[model samples]
Target: MSSTSKPSSSENIVAQKFDRCLADLIVKSGVGFSAGVIASVILFRRRAWPVALGTGFGAGMAYADCDRSFNPARIPGTRIIPASELKKDGSS
Candidate 1:
């Protein structure tokens, strides 16, 4: 007999579910953080330090939450994708 090991059916199902959940959370958290940053920038321009700081902190927390929400994994560091990657013009 061959000595190969295969993942059980339940393991495959669990992996699929976890992947779907992770994708959804990533999208949601990314959007939320983007909106928060934009709002914070506007507030900063208006000389509202409190509002700006609060919004920035919220964005960081959201990112942390998304990183931890995934199963069978832990993001080693903070997830802060640079805004340049999200630009429409694709100019970095």
Candidate 2:
């Protein structure tokens, strides 16, 4: 007899929530960065140095936002185990 089990309702709900969060983050960050770049280019064409610089900075910040959103390692409260904690046999 096979004993394969289906996922619980709670598990499916949690997975859906995670997927939605990821999708929202990607869309928001991507739109923010694209808008910044576009504004920067427009300001640059108008010879507005301060506005151009501000938009460029915003674009960079948006890029970082996207990176952190998708990569769990970039999340805060995550600890990095020191190399000294490793065993001489190359195992953690």
Candidate 3:
């Protein structure tokens, strides 16, 4: 007999989803940070603070956007809107 309890199928599915979301967040943040760094270097040389600030901001935005899309949660009185929520009838 096994000593450890095996996870159910539903639990496994949830875990897999969580893992996928985490991977997406990491990839998106990395790409965004790299792009920001390159842009900062091209736009402003010798600006260490700007480069760091831009990288952080870009990465944060990328992560938030990915989260919003992947795990959408309806929030009241929030200005931020997901792209998928937009309707063709011109109604929010």
Candidate 4:
């Protein structure tokens, strides 16, 4: 039971992260779409490009953020500790 629960706990964390990412994507994309609609009516003269551009920009930002969250080492100047060092240092 203990062994089974350990993997389940890690899976739960992954599920939570995925849920957060999905929520962020929806919210950011919705805001961008609203902004685009406003701009289209006022500035673009009912053009479609602004709407598409805004959606892509929002999605791209969300993707970047999600990638960063999943891969901490991808960020610049992040120190990656080796497994051996972690064991030696006795750090969690």
Could you report the Cα RMSD, in angstroms, for every candidate shown?
Answer: 15.9, 9.5, 10.6, 4.7
Report the Cα lDDT for candidate 2: 0.63
User: Model 4, range 1-92, lDDT digits (tens) per residue?
Assistant: 35455445878878888888899899888888888888899999999989988887888888888888888898889999999998988965
What is the overall TM-score of model 1 with all chains considered together? 0.39
Model 3: lDDT of residue 64: 71
Cα deviation at 72, candidate 2, in Å, is: 23
The lDDT leader among the candidates is 4
Backbone atom clashes (below 3 Å) for every candidate: 0, 0, 0, 0
* Model 4 TM-score, 2 decimals: 0.79
Q: How far is candidate 1 from the true structure (C-alpha RMSD, Å)?
A: 15.9
Q: What does candidate 3's lDDT look like per residue over 56-91, in tens digits?
A: 775676567656655556333557556766664357
- Please say which candidate is ahead in lDDT: 3 or 4: 4
Q: What's model 3's TM-score? A: 0.49
lDDT of 1 by residue, 1-92 (tens): 56897756987866876676667656665666666567667755644554545555655665566556643257566565568766855764
Q: Which sections of candidate 3 miss by over 4 Å?
A: 1-8, 49-92
Residue 73, candidate 2: C-alpha displacement in angstroms: 28
From the highest lDDT down, the ranking of the candidates is 4, 3, 2, 1
Error of 2 at 31 (Å): 0.5
